[model samples]
Target: MSSAFDDFELKGHKLDNRFVVAPMTRTSADSKGKPTELMGDYYARFAEGGWPLIISEGVYTDRQASQGYVNQPGITDAPQTDAWKQVVERVHKHGAKFIMQLMHAGAQFQHNEYTDTPIAPSEVKPKGEPLALYGESDGWKPPKAMDESDFDAVMQGFVGSVNRAEEAGFDGVELHAANGYLLNEFLSEHFNQRGDQWGGDIGHRLKFVAMVAKACKDAAKGENFIVGIRLGQITVTDPDYQWPEGEDAMIKIVKALKEAGIDYIHTTDTDVSRKPFKGGSNKTLAEIVQEFSDIPLIVNGGIDESNYEHIAAHYPNALLALGKKALANPDMPKRLKDGETIEDLEFAMLQPTATLENEWQWRDEHDKHIEAD
Candidate 1:
């Protein structure tokens, strides 16, 4: 069985180990959606701590309805792209590969600079309240159903973001199709009630995402640039919801993504071991991906040092992506390798908000040693 710490290669990029810093939302960018120097330091710390790959926070893809939070960073303009270049430099200085996660919040939006309204595949709203940790929106509002022009704009936003990521010196980009975002909304039956090519059945629902994947791949054609996606059945606010087609739907989704030239598939769930789909499938979602596709896989959810070895043994070739644990211990891989105690994440660190500045202040007050540059 392969160890989680074993060196691996994702696409053509050589990874130091199979541990990746999963994409996390840190609404700490400047009001103009430009990444700040603090954000650069925040990311570089993880790489210096020893994670091989880092998938960035959900970056807004367009100026329309994509801005999900008050200060969420975006990549629609040159200044934003230039700001990310500094972040990329910081990560590379620590010898880590960085992939920007492009996102368009569908209906889970709390605030947007350009528009007051949100947009989705259908006019539906998300099931639960806005995350208290992300923002202070009272409740979700009904969204405008995407039209033909909206579809074209969404496509261009993603394509343009990928091109900007390439120019900004990022290793690649991961389409944020998970966590109830625009692409995930398109995949979801709850949010996609359209009768057109963008929605209807499972096949139609997969069309837009597949098209986006192909467009991203086309934009990032050479230079060992990687294009991947994150997918899950559960939304941030609605965890109990399941796809109508269950395991069969997930299998079909994986097949479609592979055919669309997605270099990797990152699956997140409540746990890596749980069979989350309906109809009582024996296989976990990660297992289904391994069975259906030959590309690289990144598995997240409830992974820690205690069970990571076992999880690694199960998915021998897959990378182990961690969020909560990584937050508590940025040097998680090195800590595990050296038999050091890995810190557990206290909700206090992210209490007021999930921003970089808040985390730093919490660490200071709690005497948590943050490494200096």
Candidate 2:
């Protein structure tokens, strides 16, 4: 079977390898919402270590309420764009393609922290209480339902972000549509109770995504910028948020995305091996998306070296996106391609601080060992 190191052409870009570094929030940016030198060093290390495609952490759009976490990177203004330009240049120099995952936190915001009320398609509260960044403990508050004006503003915000991303020298942009964010909120009937064109049934529910896609395409003009969407089987807030409409809703959405001219579709599941649809079948979401979409498809979640061969054998054209695995072993793609076993590859720890702490500790220990030598 072809390994993760196999080179493939995705959206006209010749990716050196099929293993993509999935976007994981580091919250390592400075207070100005610009990436810091340390953050740049961290991502550059991964690129240098051999990940072919590195999808940067979720970057907040222009909306103030879109700031999901403290110290999360933003691509809102000129300085942020300049900072991202540096990041893109570094990653490209290291022979890796960088895509900015543009995201709006939507109603998933902690009202106590950023704004008094988070705006969503509907005035629906998310499942659980919101946690503050790190040690802060202010709880959750119900979000405000977005009116027509708010919706228009959000669309404009996304468009502005896309323009900024292109200006920042990113190779492409991935719309963060998954994880119970704004797009997902619109998709879920529970969250989206609007009677307008932006809500209601599946067709209307998908309008937000369609609008965003069109806006992004318009902002980029005719640039060959890759536009991808990251969609999940279930959202974080609603683990039980399965649709009674089954794969039909998902199929319809994929068809719509394909029609929208998106370059690729990135599907996420709790486990890559698990089916993305509500049914507990072995048919993965990538397979289903491929059936519906004419564009390329990338699959992420619970991917490791052990399952690489199996996945490759089964899904030939599918690109595997590795999150925790990439974090733990930056050279994992090379290792897998070399036919080396990666059962012992370190698993990534949860939360940004923990990841930073572990990386720092390991660096210190390695430095001391080098000194001893």
- Separate clash counts for every candidate: 0, 0
Which model scores highest in TM-score? 1
lDDT (Cα, tens digit) per residue for candidate 1, span 114-185: 998898999999997898898688788789999888888889999999999989999999998888889999
Give candidate 2's TM-score.
0.90
Q: Using lDDT, give the best candidate's number.
A: 1
Worst 10 residues of 2 by lDDT: 364-373
> Model 2: per-residue lDDT, tens digit, 48-159?
7677788988888864578777777888889988988877887888778888998888877742234667888888877876653332436655778887677777788788
The regions of model 1 sitting more than 4 angstroms off are none
TM-score of each: 0.98, 0.90
- In model 2, what is the error at residue 67, expressed in angstroms? 0.9
Each model's C-alpha lDDT?
0.91, 0.75
